[model samples]
Target: MSIQTELTEQLNRYSVDFIRFVDVSALPEEQNKGFPYAILFGIALTPEYIQEITNQPDYIQQKIKREAIHRDEFHLKERKTDRLADELADFLTQKGFTAYSQSEENLAQTGSYNEAIQQTSLPHKTIAHLAGMGWMGKHDLLVTPEYGSAVSMCTVLTDAPLETVLYSPEESMCGECQVCVDVCVPGALKGKTWNIKTSRDEIVDIAHCTTCLRCLVMCPWTQRYAQRPVAVR
Candidate 1:
């Protein structure tokens, strides 16, 4: 079997919903040096959990294990992604390959898109798109046909000569779907379709985003499982 296939099978032992690797050598030399291939993986969030989150206040008022908690549930999932990425990086290192990993909570925020347009030092979103995991959404979030933006991403960079897939970027699936834009409480989303060249400002105004994450819940794909009536046992 190819090394890529073996690695994919190994990582599948973890709770991964998606996984892919892509060449990122075309990017700036500063953030990326010898590590050209980015190992991207994502975990799908609980549709019911996301559906319950109507806004920040809703998230804040959530009860977990019979106790009220704020953002704890969300951060818990981010930690899971980080843990798996760390393990995977270590696994690669043990095999005599150099690897570095990053997660949402453990981001290399040299800066943010809110600051300079190109300030994001290590953008996992860009890596994920290039890896063919999904397309950039008009909502300024990675949108996958299978799970929409309801998945948390983890990234790792390595220089190992592993077999990688030939990628043709996933095309935007939100054609004329203004649900995310229309439901955006703060009007952060631009309702514009996304392409490889679409800039952050063209799709989203970060300043206007309240981080309520209402747009995530508004994604049509997110509601796929939620729309079904509960099966009474």
Candidate 2:
């Protein structure tokens, strides 16, 4: 089997919802840390959990339940993605390639989502966009056609000679969709349309966000994921 195929198969064995090998050499050298390639992968959050959080009537109660779900379900999937990253890195190392997983450091900062975003040198959202797994949403989250923004992502940097795709920063797919912006109680979303040149701060005011996740829950793409027939895993 091809190395890329073999690696993808292994990731699938671990229930990775999405996987991509991408050439990250286009990123600033300091950002990628001289790694020519990266393995980007994600695990989806439980739709039922998201639905419950989305359907809660009381805003305060929704926030409370969202925190519990983030702690139990979201972080648990993050840990799972971390483990998969480590395993993939080890697998590459065993084959005489240089590999490093970023999951452990990112997980350490998972106590606060905003903190994690602030501290990450190469955000997984950036990597996911580079990998063509998704586009940047108006809410500044990576919105995949499949799972929307409901997937927790992980990354592994490597010097392995795995085949990789190179894509220009894709144009945003979220055409005129403002559900996430309108639902932001803190008015954190600026209702800006994203393009390759648009900065995260242009679309979202992180300082103003309370991380209430109303945007995440009300997002139409996320709703599609939640309402889709459950797959028998």
Query: What TM-scores do the predictions have?
Result: 0.80, 0.84
lDDT of 1 by residue, 87-162 (tens): 8788789888888777543344423232444345667788887777778877888887677788877788888776
| Per-candidate total of colliding backbone pairs | 0, 0
lDDT of 1 at 59: 60
- lDDT of candidate 2 over 1-113, digit per residue (tens): 76778889999998887888888887888678799999998888889868876876254445466775445576688788888888888898898888878786534554313
- Cα RMSD of all models vs. native, in order, equals 4.0, 3.6
Q: What lDDT is reached at residue 16 by model 1?
A: 83
- Per-residue lDDT of 171 in model 2: 81
Specify the poorest-scoring 10-residue window by lDDT in model 1. Answer: 105-114
How far is 184's C-alpha from truth in model 1 (Å)?
1.6
Which pairs clash in model 1? Answer: none
Stretches of model 1 off by over 4 angstroms after superposition? 1-6, 54-57, 60-71, 104-106, 109-119, 228-233
